[model samples]
Target: MKVNWFRRQHPLQNGDQLRCHALAKSPIPAHCLELFQKSYPAPNSPLSELKCVVLDFETSGLDPKQDEILSVGMVDIHYPVMSLASAQHYYVQSEQVIHSKTAVINHIVPETLIGGISRHQLIERLVVSLSGKVVIAHGAEIEKHFLRHLLQLDASLPLPLIFLDTLRLERSLMKYRGVMYPDLRLTHVRQQKGLPPYLAHNAFADVVATGELFLALVEEICADKPPLLGPLVLRSL
Candidate 1:
């Protein structure tokens, strides 16, 4: 029989809060979802022991207040290992539409960009995927701000997320070693560490790069066996 690597071993999670998929469209207050906290690994758990969801977003613009989250891409991580079995990509439905300038970077053509799910629906799906996992991203603050801003707009979009940022980690390591550069783009950073080049812009691909970069960083930080995850967390900016 084949194995389902990403399958949730515990179909009945202990004290798991209401399933995001089962919830109605109506908004739920943050306090109401407190019991579901355990769905994700504890903030202090070992990085190698926690399951993570690598995340990347392509937006209509850079500013969260003005720009829209054009797309979201993610892949699940089994602790220190990466897996593509559970990868996902979704383009958000919007009235603003994709601009030519941004399109050049994200490679989401006009035709393929059509037919998107509502933000609420996307959040529902994201919540279900992320309920019990850590989040990995190149620059986590971007995703965090955008998601939090969306949550503020729609309370039902609640997700308690902890992020592992590859770019930030690399920069810190470089700085500690007294290195500096003009740019620290994802592909650039990955190449600096001898990782093979990959096409940029696509959210899924970016997440994959970020995931791989994270593993490489862990190899450096942990050496053989790193301590608990609490110490590695990057504080909210």
Candidate 2:
């Protein structure tokens, strides 16, 4: 009797299912586990003083629990120049074959990331790189979900770093306005506001777009008052 390799209990693809099973069976490194459990800053922790890291991730699939992250990109935003020199992008090498459809969407092929670092190493590097910074992501739920799974993989994983969703900020900015665009897509919003075009599916490009959108929304929200970053809340209609 032969067992079907693809007919596993989980819906995970072959490579991901194999990696998940392996991680579950083996003891994860104690030090690596410790880093995951590290703590982050709180809301009252002085936003002005805190560094903001804009992040974006392109993954093979949507499920953070099952799908693998193919690439991670981030840019450090500290006002002044908004320099690209502070950006970081990592591609993860995976044994999993890239689905043709997904590849068409994300434009990341296995061959493209062949000599890149591993997922575990990428996570470790990201953790260290993002330390002592507030994380900003456009439509942050996906990123948060991914981070949650990463933390859960190691029990000692700390809570997520401070997070600000640019999607939420954009939504808040449009709340009081009478005219509303039919589509709230990021690209649509950028174009409507006369902002630069972003090549979708590229993590670095998305991060830069999110950063610009965040700044634009902030300016709109802080029109009457001295510019300050705070909890951006949507006013009820």
- Taking all chains together, the TM-score of candidate 2 against the true structure is 0.75
Candidate 2's residue-wise lDDT over 86-162, tens digit each? Answer: 88888888777899998998899988898888767886887777766667787787887887675455543324355
Clashing pairs in 1: 39-132
Q: For candidate 2, what is the total of clashing residue pairs?
A: 5
* lDDT (0 to 1) per candidate: 0.70, 0.67
- CA displacement after TM-score superposition, residue 208 of candidate 2 (Å): 1.5
Q: What's the TM-score of each model vs. the native?
A: 0.78, 0.75
Clashes per model (N, Cα, C within 3 A): 1, 5
What is candidate 1's lDDT per residue for 1-237, written digit by digit as tens? Answer: 112422333222211222333134445555334324445444457776777889998898888888888788999988667888889989888777678998888877657658977888777877777766777888888888887777563544534556677777787787778888625788888888899998788887888888888888878766787645554564211
The true-structure Cα RMSD of candidate 1 reads 9.6
What residue runs in model 1 are displaced by over 4 Å at the alpha carbon? 1-36, 39-44, 153-159, 180-182, 234-237
Model 2: per-residue Cα lDDT at residue 59? 85
Model 2 lDDT, full chain set: 0.67
